[model samples]
Target: MSEISILKDFQKRQMLFMELYKKAFPAVARYISRKGGNYEEAKDIFQDALVIYYEKLISKSFSPINNEKAYILGIAKHLWIRKLGSNVINDTIESAESEAVFAEEHLRTDKLIYLLETAGKKCMDILRAFYYEKASITEIAQQFGYSGTRSATVQKYKCIEKIRETVKEKSLAYEDFIE
Candidate 1:
């Protein structure tokens, strides 16, 4: 694709991502909380999933073979499972399912993190602030010295798209790690 077309496509995907994020976050938070995870854990899992999604998109390697919602939710589920597994929780059927999902999710999450770490300090800073710190666009703009919140928002979206592309290229899935 031409530069303009690629940029436009990316922008479109970013808008979709933000919308999906807004919609899925609450359900994800509730799921985690119900499973004995705290608010902080829910937030971390959600953010990690978004980071993975962003990495997949930015690398020009992601193709939407399935519903975006499922893809993102799968990532979140996997991350939550990993978090639970690392804790000394009792292993029940539900917990086992979570563990299974998490084992699958970890491989992708690990790769996504590796790619994000390689994306340099700026991408990491923006992702950390927006995803982990839960900072607003205005706050990030001020902190990053952007011209305005709009600029910061745009930059954040672009960074997320990059992450999504990176994840997609690998075609990692929950089934991959499940035996």
Candidate 2:
């Protein structure tokens, strides 16, 4: 491409990015805000999401997306979730105003674990191995004598689902009992 054409293309992309920022950022900001993230974090995630969107746009497999705003918002949401998974809990702990909340959270976590135990030792073991031990599916399969990784993966999902159900069932009962 000629230098003038290249400059024009860059200008076009710059305008497109600016437009995307104006059109898509509010929804992303609101989502991150509702999830307890600050404005700065929302901006950071949105910027990162824009970078990802641009990369995807330029890739060989790129397909024209009909809703750029939704695409960018979805990317921002995933990035925020990943950020939460990595550091939000530690941040929350460090910034907590009172130890009471922390202690209560600890107690609730312990109770959940105890409830999981009551559900079944095998399910608890499966969860502990995968999450706490960070065991790979193959390792879990080998250790548990599953037929294959797929079976181990299915079992792990079932264990997680069971935990969710246990928590949902117990949360109301536990809160009532505590009060």
The candidate that achieves the highest lDDT relative to the unseen native structure = 2
lDDT of 2 by residue, 1-179 (tens): 53234324744654566567656666666667667887678778988988798778776687877667777777777788788775333333222223323323333444544767765878876775664345799989998999999999999898878767876876645333121
Off by over 4 Å in 2: 1-8, 86-179
lDDT of each: 0.64, 0.66
Model 1, TM vs. native: 0.44
Q: In model 2, which residue pairs have backbone atoms overlapping below 3 Å? A: none
lDDT of 2 at 80: 88
Superposition error at 166 for model 2 (Å): 52
TM-score of each: 0.44, 0.44
Clash counts for all predictions: 18, 0
The residue-level lDDT of candidate 2 at 35 comes to: 77
Tens digit of per-residue lDDT, candidate 1, span 1-179: 53234435734554555566545555555556567776677677877887787667656656643445456666777777776666443444454345444434443444535767665679878986776556789989998999999999899888877776765776754333223
